[model samples]
Target: MPEETAKQTHFYSVEAPDGSYDLRIEEMLARIESTAAPIYMRLINGKIPEHQDKMDMAQFLAVMVVRTPGSRKDAAEMVGRMIQIRNYATGVHDRAFNSLVHRIEQGEGRQLTEESRTSLRRSLIDPSGYRLELGKEWALQHLTAADKLTPVLFQMRWRTIGAAQGFFITSDDPVVRWVEPKTWHPIYGDHGYLNKTAVVTFPLTPKVMLAMSWEDEGANAFAGRQGVDRLNRLRALQADEYLYAHLDHEVIRRMAVATKGSRPRMTTEGFGPKKFAATTLRRGRANRPS
Candidate 1:
């Protein structure tokens, strides 16, 4: 490690060696996994998790939400946006000037003074130029977010459901937040973690799933083939990149094909006067699944 990095006190103490923070995060996650392991086994064996077990499981899921590659991607993008804003605030105008010049050359058909160009370029600058490659330092932010989200997850009504037929498929980004079609809106897109209609779901295994919702309708139920298929479709729609299952089946292929054009997407948009907003829609959740 560089002398400066060695002295930085953030994720791990200054006295700790380089990579200590990463190991610490891994060990923390491992501890949560170990705690949740028995709960998972109980659910798999057709037992309802105790209240304390539920809280442990909720913490496991909450931390899982922040630890995935998809979450890291979102965090990196957020940092890029913040850097762009910082640059703009600090009067870094080179990118904006280049963007304005390119637009003028591309026949925007506007005549403008240098002052006009200077003012207009701010709106035309490409945010991608400010992107950053984040490192393990981001683990602190993830841990804090996970800590805050645990209670919200614990407060929700949880259900441990079994699939009567067919299997559940999970993905690289697997924790899924879904809203009823009736409550969905084009602009809002309806996957907000706090949305009253939103139900967060995770497949515990090929035959069982854990679902948390604000509603009380579906607790501890067995989903039939149709229900299982519906849940699988949600998994397909929400997958970040890859899917996993115990068995290789044609259903997976079919799902991949069916949801190809409509996969969930997480994006940042409204780059101009509106500024950038991180939006999580059915096409994407901010953090991915287990």
Candidate 2:
């Protein structure tokens, strides 16, 4: 029993801001649904309004697809696009937000104002009030890119927090600063060497954090690992395809079962320098003995 218990690992309990994760997600979903419902109703009723731009409607539909449960990254990109569109549609009262949004929208990126940049830094590090989805690669890319533009602000925020409290797990490699190098894998055999991928830990705050292992190599194989089963199940249902064919009935059934409940609070574990050093010493002594 002691051995069994020792092998069982536990993560930290990190609650979302004000315990409002569900409320926030629900609000985002409702807003997206409201935006899309009218378009769907028009299509269902066969009221083909001539003024309705199919292209715009298609984009809106894409937005809807991304917002559905388990579509975090897609939703985040769609939301980013939506934010851009809104900025364009509504003239900005503050020149700062408008400028930053315009530069991002245009290929020509611009420098962020100290105040606006500070806010973005806080958003990237905390990621609480900000609704950008972390599950998607594109969303992570955007967040990373945004952070780069305001490195000073980000560094300042990081420094304010204790060293052990940040989201990323530092490594010897510099590339690990962005996304984990190990996460990048070769898509094709002839594509050349693959990079080392690392698991990125996204800390929500003092307690809650989510870790995602992004890799270019053997994504399918990695997804099969037990730790990622729940996430993979959700993604499979959303994707609706396995290799070439649709999922087996049993797989679909399992996926449905897995996703039936409400979203649970994220889990965090304290595995810092202290824990690492302690574990290493214990293993060394055990190995040295007869």
Candidate 3:
């Protein structure tokens, strides 16, 4: 992707000049709400079969496409596994987590402790032109061992026919912002295996949040609408149907694999009285590669 293009759309707006939820996702939210409790549950729980979270852009939208609730509760289970890190990189997922020591004498409401805040700002956020993206170094020193103790691969597939990572936002406003925190949870009905699954979190914009494959882990990743192009990219996706269709499946797959791991497998009810393996992508989930 062109650096210029990425820059323009990375930021997102939550409101319009007239001040209503951005229309692009406004209708999407209504769908989620109207889809009934079950569809809403599937909307943000897990994107793929194996890896529950650290969901990339494509996986999240694919969940939104499911407008109807399945006949059974267990039918929502998704599955898969992944492994595609480059040789040049050990992968940010692999590293000895480092501890940080900071004294937060004071802090504002719902923010990190003052001391931790100072360290993050000085080292990560304050740097000129920095977006505070998480890297291996950031992971080692800042992020501790999340719920999972070690590195894990994630499952991924791109069935949607647009830019796999982004969607349109119907906001005319020049700016939009919202706070997102990373969290993880043990896969809900995993029986036993997926006790330590990666929580699927994605870039926000509730449409995005509702689509989150939420795990119980406390929020860690903090997303802000500071990037220069957050707004443009959202609207651009809204307008460019053909552009969205041009997807890089390979990269998206690798991304899903590199970023996280799968949850415990479950059993889902098939079309009727018989229940098939839940790990299968029959629950409104599909992909080119399992």
Task: Report the number of the highest-TM-score candidate.
Answer: 1
Candidate 2 yields a Cα-based lDDT of: 0.32
In the range 1-290, model 1's lDDT, one tens digit per residue, is: 65655442332211134323335665677799999999878877667666889889889989878766566556655664565555444334576556546666578676677787665555334333222343445434555788888888988887777888988989877888887778777777665677798889899888889888888865588989999988888877866667788988998888888786465444545533234434221211123210
Candidate 3 local lDDT, residue 280: 22
Which one wins on lDDT? Answer: 1
lDDT of 2 by residue, 1-290 (tens): 65545541111112244642223434544565566467545543333222333333333333432333233333344544443334333332356545645665476565556776556534433333433222232332232332232222111111011113212121111011133335544442221112223332222222222232324232112122343333333333334222111224454456556544433221223321111110111111111110
TM-score of model 1 (CA atoms):
0.70
What are the models' TM-scores? 0.70, 0.22, 0.18
Higher-ranked by TM-score: 2 or 3:
2
Number of clashing residue pairs, candidate 3: 28
lDDT of candidate 3 at residue 42, scale 0 to 100: 46
RMSD of 3: 24.4
lDDT of each: 0.68, 0.32, 0.27
Model 3's alpha-carbon lDDT is 0.27
Model 2 TM-score is 0.22
Those runs of model 3 whose alpha carbons end farther than 4 Å from true positions after fitting are 1-73, 76-251, 257-263, 267-290
Q: What are the runs in model 2 whose C-alpha is more than 4 Å off?
A: 1-18, 22-25, 49-56, 68-290
